[model samples]
Target: MSKSEEASQRPDTPHYENATGGWGSLKGVSRILADQKPTFGAFRTLMRQNKPGGHMCTSCAWTKPAQPHLFEFCENGAKATIWDLTRERCTPDFFAEHSLTELRGLSDHELEKTGRLTHPMRYDATSDRYVETTWEEAFEGIGAKLKELDPGATVFYMSGKASLETAYLYALFARLYGHNNLPDSSNMCHETTSVGLKRVIGVSVGTCVLSDFDHCDLILFFGQNTGTNSPRFLHTLKAAKERGCKIVTFNPIRERGLVEFADPQNPAQMTVRPATRISDIYLQVRPGGDIAVLAGLCKRVLELDAERGSTILDRAFIAEHTTGLDELEARLREVSWEEIERESGLRRDELNEVAGIYATSKNVIGIYGMGLTQHVRGWLNLAMLVNLLLLRGNIGREGAGISPVRGHSNVQGQRTVGITEKPENVPNDKLRELFGFEPPQEEGRSTVDLVEGLLDGSVRGLVSMGGNLARAIPDRARAEGAWRGLELNVQIATKLNRSHLLPGRATWLLPCLVRAEEDMQATGPQAVTMEDSLSMIHGSLGRRQPASPHLRSEVAIVAGIAKATLPPNPRVKWDEWTGDYGLIRDLIEATYPDKFKDFNGRLFTPGGFHRGNAAREREWKTESGRAQFTAPEALTALGAPPEGQEITLITLRSNDQFNTTIYSFSDRLRGLSGPRDILLINPEEMERRGLSEGQVVTLECAVDDGAERVVRGLRVVPYDLPDACVAAYYPEANPLIPVSYRDELSKTPAYKGVPVRIRTDEAGA
Candidate 1:
């Protein structure tokens, strides 16, 4: 029953203060259409979610708008399509009336409201529950536990909600069942924006193109919150502030979704002009202060480029397209504007007014999130924000680049179709010249080496393919005790989270079909494809049908577990690739033909195509053929607490939560109601910690070599956070951080700057 016993000491508080979107985004879209009291077949399955004829809103990656907006979903994408068109049902007699230990004391939002998992069950273990079965005996008992494990002891993971034809046929059936170990959900949030934008801009997604935030004239956002993680990126920052741009905003928690949003399709913000105020300059900084406010705005754009008429950088694109510019102007003159104002609580006159609005912006861009990649030098805070957007030549041309505002929606197309755990340099020779084998060249196992290979037993086997990894990992009793020390887990799900109640010694589940449903398959009616976060791709097409016709369609349950564990293959043809997902997009365009070229005729091209960016055409595929400049060394602070009553914290996602979906424990833009054991904190550090405002407390935080991290009770509230900062909500403070804290060069989970220390609720009074 633990994931910190689903945060208790309930404390409601909320009385409106988070000023984002008007009528609080039409009351969080009328409380997700009154908790999906739906049916006109769920209102025609919410008019095909992101509509280009159907399905796309796998929540937030905010892209779709190249002229298409008849309500392209977004109240958290209409509560992720009313939390997957829920009408409720766990079926098979609700697992013969509940028992995996009474569904492990419920809450992972009450096991996703006890709904949707329909058929394929398994786990009997002398009737501890979950019985139903047979999709050919649950794919031959998970292909006989992948033939009694040891293709480096099974891992797979995936889950940024699958599709890109089920993560390229679940990495071509775990590299034709020998295992590349895969790992994904981008190894826990933007694998430091794909290994720090592929080492400072060669590639690793984000080159900008949501029309580059509409002709960028200046738009920063480092460590973004964009009105609660992509509240439709505040209508592209309110149409780039009515087209005269200049946004700014870094965070520590000013967020009312970045100060002013209100577009419930604008009724002039519900009667007369006033809700589009998005940041002109907000800058709170401090939780592992974005590489000392990007090294004091790249050392004040190198003292305004050494003053002789003050040009401010771009010395012919840093001597022809980059390469460590004089060791980044000697590590920004050996750090010290008093250690960038003691590690960016900001002010060297707010880093020269943010380097004079980034040296008079001639097309800039930046935007960031996960507070610049959950730190431990989150890949040197995205290489000091690409060394402050290459000091001026703000990435590849017109209306600038760099974006990284990621968070699901096809997790950059499941790591652009292959879901790596490092295939010793991806695109494994275009998947060994279009699947003739030779792929698993080892080096795999990421979601932090599969929870340290399920706590050193060398990982025992889990398939996952849709995430809830014991409530999104980061130590919650060591990721549910290494997912209850797996023996073979499986899960290809649609609902019921808490990693499907962790069982394993062969636990199963299956279920599936949810990108707005209907996937007729056997070649006659299916559609798939995903990618967005501006690498575009598109083609969703679900059009609502399978509420539970025994579900299956995460590309037919990874093609029925790859034709029940591959014993005969004609160089890969799993039942004519599970009745043609256009032959798995023609073998993913014969394995990445320069990014799926004409991949199904660009789904009749409306707003799809782009997948382009190698720094948008000034190419530079690193290893010396340019674009490098790294420098960053003065981190100054994030945890030197001893004289401060230590705080830090961060965590996030409550505006009706998304990743690890919890649609409404009521977070109407942070007024928060029903309760997820609250936290927030800094009203002058709760009057310098005598603490009050709904008190409760308890937090703790353990890290130097892990374990003992706390949590208990919580409540607190006070907020407008900063000194000794604090904030909570995430699979409820993901059990106070430490699943090996992280970012040893992008392993990710430092879940937004955690340090911790609160206390007083002493085991909840």
Candidate 2:
């Protein structure tokens, strides 16, 4: 039989569907509850998610509305909760049943399915197993290792799931330990957004709030899939659509959430009517083509202004609130329509049509995610989007601005509370006054920098708040190997993950409380705070009991580490802060009084308080004192691939996954089931290459690092994507992305775009 014919018999061929978030979404939630069979009341716990004074969903950073619905959680949120509240425990006996070598062979999903960690454990090198240890012993050993090494040589990593209080304590603890080597998940996902927006608008975050969508006339999406990444955002898009907002999306694949959505909240929409159409216009731009598309939009807008008596351009806003218009205009004028169309995989008229839509609309909101940020020119990609918005003064106005959707529930919050590698970003003077210590001024290593340090023996220790760092990062061949050779590795987490298997010499696994579970401290049941995507700070209080008796709160864990590593400071009372989380809020208020005045009292209020973004009020915190328009020198930063490896790969998240956590082996939105090791390519591309469905192929990266960087046994499945653009799940595809290949400014690994060649894995077949 022919390869195509033989492959056609496979059951998991790629399928496209238009509907998302109706019955399918509800079914997804039900499946997780049925499969995991939570020991705790899943529905009861879910009812409290994202509600006032209830624990925030540990899934995504999408903000909660002023008045939330009866149920304020999504399908993925349910999975995260159920996963955390699982009945199965990874106790010492469970460890005794599985050795380190045996555990290392399991996939990330399988490792997590083993269940929530129930006790503190240390690597017993003699038995090759993680034997249970007392918390005092674990902390003492970790502290001793830190005392033996230079503080600068140890890196502290924070995951996006950390609470504001936990992040604050972690940051302070690292500072007290005499180094600023702190890196978080943002360094890998949205660092470009932070770096680019700060340079252009003086703020490192997005300008739009959730309510802004209610007033926006036009909403443009670039490289973000809301259905899987942040399902709550679909309601925002649906609301905007119902109000006659023109939604335009530019993505390589037509995402179901962006095209149509069936709201589970609305009974009529769920049971009576068809799915609501979300996007008015859809542009399937080629991978790494966002820059060219953005430049083309600007070029067309300029043309419309010239043709229509300069009415299309917001000249007044540009004259008063921005600089470098002349440079931007000249650069746009120089860009040829042919080049724009060729690079963007779009025609001149399509670009003109979108530009016309923008011109007609009074207020526009530009929304994007990692697609625009994970590139070699990731910073440039965001800068171009900022320039596009600046043309018509979309920023600093109601219902109009740039919204960069963040992944982690507290990723932005972590950065807000000083979990950054850059020391200058922190209020050093306030820290000195509050903690009575001279904070480190030297810049610390970012995630990318830390990985390089691991290889060079510069960084010997890693203290993570929570995350599967080994799998999340790119260039795993070097990173995972270097991880095993570390002198000390400490992971404070709730569940077992792949990162735990790559053991250091003295690895310690510290069990901590999750968000859905109550944290009973010395004072009473403690509540933690989180800052959502809109910069709103709200409280998260858990109602369920702790998953394990041995588990401690993240705040207590950080405080314990601090007390053990540093000498007692009379000014910094670690024990007192751990007892009462309110004291930590008071300290945070004292440190950043302008942002968090009356932090304790205000947190009790419904929907929390806005942290106040300067850019939203026409206040630029940049060097120029105004929003700046930067003209990109090229259409895109992506160069030609090597002769054999022609396609560019963009890593993505499945519907069943959040970050590195996989709940199942299915993605219903894309008709993928039972496997993640499948590549989605365009039918035309597949035919041209003489490839077939279910054909095993190996994707090899185009980098000369003296190591063979490839992901083997990825079956080919035809998908709806632009030519030369293919899609694969993240972390699996992370191996093909070179560590050195990243945005120069942010150092974020190019997870969105990687040049690679495909080879038939004959041996695997």
Candidate 3:
């Protein structure tokens, strides 16, 4: 059998399609708690997952209310906490028992759940094990490698999960070292929002805050699984529903989160089990076809405007605060109804129904997720959302604007605190003022570009501040190979992951403090600041003991490396900065003065203060000095596959998964358990492809690159998805996607839309 065919054979697990949240979530929480078997020490970490004077859930960015409930967390949130705060340890002894080849063959869940790294380790290629090493030796080893390479050849990849304090020092060290190759997790998720919002609105930040959900006349949700990905968001959505606001959704699959939800917090929901209908109009959209559905709505709005004039379309606001409407309307009017129906997988009447709800509502808040951003035309999706809201005069209103939900708890905060590859975003003059050095002026590389650099032999060293970059990127095999070819690799993480296994010529595994662990520094127990999806910056102070005595804070790790690599009189006070985290915040405030004014006082604010949004106050800071109605002059090129390919593949997160982190093997909503080796295919398509339930199959990429990218051992399962749109778990299927498949504008991998061919694995038979 071919390697691809051999790779396709694996174990089997049953899937259970069950209701999301409610009693099930309670049971899940109980099971996880029992798994932790939290002693008083672990119990202390559990109670402080998301409370005042305590750390927020590091899992999701759903912010806590100013007056939050005593328990403002969910089952998944508990999983993230206990997983990070686990007593289990993967010490050097464990590494001695497992070889590199042996560890690579383990499932992602098994590797992470094995537990946190107890000490620093250096890969011993001779023995194929990671042996314990002193902190000084590890730093010196990494520092020596850094001194040998051009700073530009070193890539400092930052995870969105890194705290503001850590990100500040990481970016500072890289810039001071004369390079800006700081790619972040945003490149894989919402970089489109930052690019698109800045193109349309004056700023990349969201205009709406959490309170806007309370007063919105309508809630338009697009492709977000709130129940699983952001369970706390269900509270806001349910509240909107109870207020008589119309809710509409556009998704490729009918997510249970959108269909119906029972508030786990409400006592009545436990017994009555009455589901609050979330979406009044749920349209099953086709992958990468959101534009057509949105354009159809806008086209309908134009027809209404033609009949009764622009009053229903916010003419006054359009005239006063926006430009490009005539161009937008002209293009929208040209779209044919047939094309809309065909591309969107919905009829004209169904669209007209949504148009009716949208046309009548006075205030609307648009919510979207990776579904909108991870596409070839992902930025256009955001543009469409902005155009929809702009047409309705939703900006600068009581309950209106766009809300782009983000994943990691502090992904936005990383970008906010100088985690960018674009030199234009670095504010060189400000850095010169704060650090007494001219920052590097050259533009840096993003994640995709970093992979390209690695393959082309430019990136020599890598310092990843949390994340399994090797498994997280699209082309896993290629990413794995390129990183292994690097001269040096350093990973600062809370737990062991696949990236650790991809050792360069020299590899160092350094464990860092998680959000729950107490961070003591020269000043005192340090507090780190984080920004949420809503652009609220607040404090996160650790309270629990360090998971391992040898573990260091991310801030300390960065400082230690900086001390080893840089000159004796490096202008920045590395020791002082690490000693007091408040100094880091003070430096940040100095760097971005206007944005961080009163930063200290606001850290103690009830729910953190807003970071100043232009659109929120009806302030337009664009070159035209007004919010603009942005519409594409024409439809983008079709992203569909050619004659050979029949299926469109989407990578999905099971209810138990968090990004690339496999929290559990079972998925609550998908009814999948034990194994994540199955693919969700449309029943009719499965039969046509000569496949059966539990029958192993191989998925082949259909691109014309002359490269056959295939993933094997996929257990087929019939599902309620759009025809020819199959779903599978990522990192497993990551190898099947080419790294070249990404958004042109934002450079984000188009994880949602991969064209592939499926065939039953009758190879050896």
Give the candidate number with the greatest lDDT: 2
| Worst window of 10 by summed lDDT in candidate 1 | 2-11
Candidate 3, poorest ten consecutive residues by summed lDDT: 2-11
The reply for model 3, stretches above 4 Å from the true place, is 1-19, 633-642, 761-765
Please list all clashing residue pairs in model 3, or write none if there are none.
8-712, 8-713, 15-671, 15-672, 16-671, 17-671
The clash number for model 1 is 5
Which candidate should be chosen as best, given TM-score against the real structure? 2
TM-score of each: 0.35, 0.97, 0.96
lDDT of 1 at 582: 82
Model 1 clash pairs?
21-262, 22-262, 39-42, 227-257, 518-545
Model 1, range 1-765, lDDT digits (tens) per residue? 321122111233333453576776767777777775544565665565666656778877777765666676666777777777778777878878888788888778778877788788988878788889779998988887788788788888887767788888888788878777888777777888888888777798888887777789888887777666677777777888887897777777666777667677766677777666677677677788778888888888788778746477878887889888789778788878887787777768867876887887898988887777887678888877887888788889878888887778888887777878778556777777766777778778888788777877788888888768777887766667666668889888878887777787888888888887778867688788788888888888777767788887877778778788777766777777777788889888877788888798777366777878878887878888788888876573243433446667888877778878786687666555777787877666688778888878788884556367787887777756567678888877787777677787877887888777778855743
Rank the candidate models, highest lDDT first.
2, 3, 1
Q: How displaced is residue 740 in candidate 1, in Å?
A: 27
Tell me the TM-score of model 1. 0.35
**Scored by Cα lDDT, where does model 1 land?**
0.76
